[model samples]
Target: MRVRGRLTWGRRARAGAALLACVVAPAVVLSPGVAVAGAAAAGAAVAGTPVCQVRDDRLREISGMVATDDGYVVINDGADDEALRRIFFLNQRCAVVRSVAYPSRPRDTEDLAIGRDGTVWVADIGDNDHSRPTIAIWRLAPGAAKPVLHRMTYPDGAHDAEALLLDADGRPLVITKGGSGTVFLYAPTTALRPGATTPMASVGQVTLPRTSTSNPFLFLGRGVVTGAASAPDGRRVVLRSYADAFEYDVPAGDVVTALTSGTARITPLPDEPQGESITYSRDGRSLLTVSESADQPPGTRPTILRYPVAAAADAAAHPTGSAGPVSAGPGAPTSVRPAAEEASGAGARPWALVAGAGTLLALLGLAGVLRSRHTARR
Candidate 1:
């Protein structure tokens, strides 16, 4: 069902209340500390100013975003509809300037990166079920009409990833999303062939430091890397989770070394609902962020938030080191399967079931409200 224009008040309320119940109910049932911590974190962080609100309904599930001189470039998450699966370029006021269609429907495009030379790379590395034989990346060079596809396979096995980083040399690096704070890194072992699959070797791993940052997802959200970006100057890089953003200094343009053995400055992005998109501003002095509006009220549009680079640097005097190298062997485990993966199987959790039921009720309530309004008008 395609949603067009602004939603009515009843629809908005129904969506908001249902989603709130689904999230809040689980938090209360599980632990009160989670909610309390989230609240405290929200109060501690400096609030980001809203630059602009997304008006396009098709951009509801924005997963990856990158800042451009004109405005920004964004991509939606895995959508069943092929029409919604394209790269969108938004102007400074958050208006869709133009969009470039992918050569084919992407499996699950999760992250986006652009090189210094105006080469855009779209990472289609999301393997939630760990079943995809070969994940892929799409490259759109400067002035190219369409993106060229480059398929890649993991040397070990299939792993789910959402963060993609492009080094100063414009080489793409994929970071796995492991629930346990520790995540593995992978880089292309050989030159990428447009139509042929290339093997990705396990390079190293880094464990994100535990923080007191609060988010809707609570503790589980702290470890997952949702999005990534590099500084335009090539001096720094960042990886963000649902709750916070971690920035590392890239010494001499070696992004891999920075991720494997660097100290990270942590900035809390508190209480973001499914925050998944991040990028550095054109000047590299601030970080811009956007969240998916799925859990927000109906008709709610996602807004871009800007945080100063100094805020992150000043969060801690002596930031703890969170990077470390791991064995780059084929036997190395790339990721610890998240709870959602387990829930996808026979052992589904009770909280997940409750959330599903709440969603159904929300849909039914919206239908009833719409139907009653039509009858009243007649």
Candidate 2:
């Protein structure tokens, strides 16, 4: 009587990918010719090329991604009790260097950014239902014993956010995934004390060009902003979506001006499996993109793509302006946990507990899934 033995990683990612498919899939099935034509058109639109593919199963649900001198660090989007909240470190070859578990559970981290001082900031500010009065941001200086959690509340109201950026001084700045298409700004007004709730200052706004969201397929190229990454010097940044990525050259560290009045260099992305994460390479010469893999049977895993920035940087059509007000917690002293002591390999799997009724569901659900898998293998 197996309970949850058959609930594999690929199956879990497929569930996420299925959601994207449903949103973009057409109601009427396409004819064979139309399908081929659609694929061709899609191919033409994806100009960003992939440098390599990451094969790790743990990162199949990766959401927040940022590149560091050592490698790219990422985290899963799961916020539930049964879900994991760990940081996965990937090297240049897209191989796992390490996976660091959090000291405690994070509510709903959606994006990540690296500050000027080499500190990693994790955006725990996700309010899908706008039910939370306050959201949190986690700060980590790699090899730290624990994260410094900085909690903040929106001054206006609860607004869902997935993008976060730290200024040259390590201050946190958030952009709301608002309906107005005007990227709403939320800057911290005071030093982010670990336990104190700080007020999010609305100092400025960056109104992006409004795009239609009627057709699901087309919407991929024109949906709400999902992720953001700023250049190391705070001189540039990029905003990402499901199917497209826009680059802004922040002139004089001004992000608001770029978002509002500056022209952006748009780079269309290939159809990614629930793609949501984007970042800049350590050298600031290329853009790296990641997707949440729905690695179904005989399908693809999450891909790590590097879009050439040499041309894009030289061809900056319009420069972005900047200004700001924000706060960041004082750096908390940290001690690294020993590699042997930290979870690794199989031990790194999330902390999940199931009992009673959950056990029953696992048995039935696992049986059906196992049966289908066996049939597929045959």
By lDDT, who's the top model here? Answer: 1
- Tens-digit lDDT track of model 2 for 1-378: 001334432344245334544432332122233234344444445345676677876565677899888778888765332334677778877798777666667766789998776678888876655667788888888568667887899888887788897765667889875532456878889989988999988967765432221222243234457789997667778887655566776666667665665555555554555566899988888778887544532577767787765233333332233232111111100211222222232423231111223334433543344334310100
Per TM-score, the best of the predicted structures is: 1
The stretch of ten residues in a row with the least summed lDDT in candidate 1 is 326-335
Candidate 2 lDDT score at position 320 = 36
> For model 1, what is the error of residue 2's alpha carbon versus the real structure, in angstroms, after optimal superposition?
13
Question: What C-alpha lDDT values do all the predictions have?
Answer: 0.73, 0.61
**Tens digit of per-residue lDDT, candidate 1, span 1-378:** 112343532245335555656554763355444344434545566656789988887788788999999999999877666667889999999999888998777887889999998888999987655767888899989888889999999999888898999877777899997765889999998889987999999999988866656566545567779899998998889889887788887878999888888777666676666788899999998889998655375556888988777433331443334433221111111222343442353323545667556656654654454333210100
What is the Cα-based lDDT of residue 225 in candidate 1? 90
The segments of candidate 1 whose C-alpha lies over 4 angstroms from its true place after superposition are 1-40, 311-378
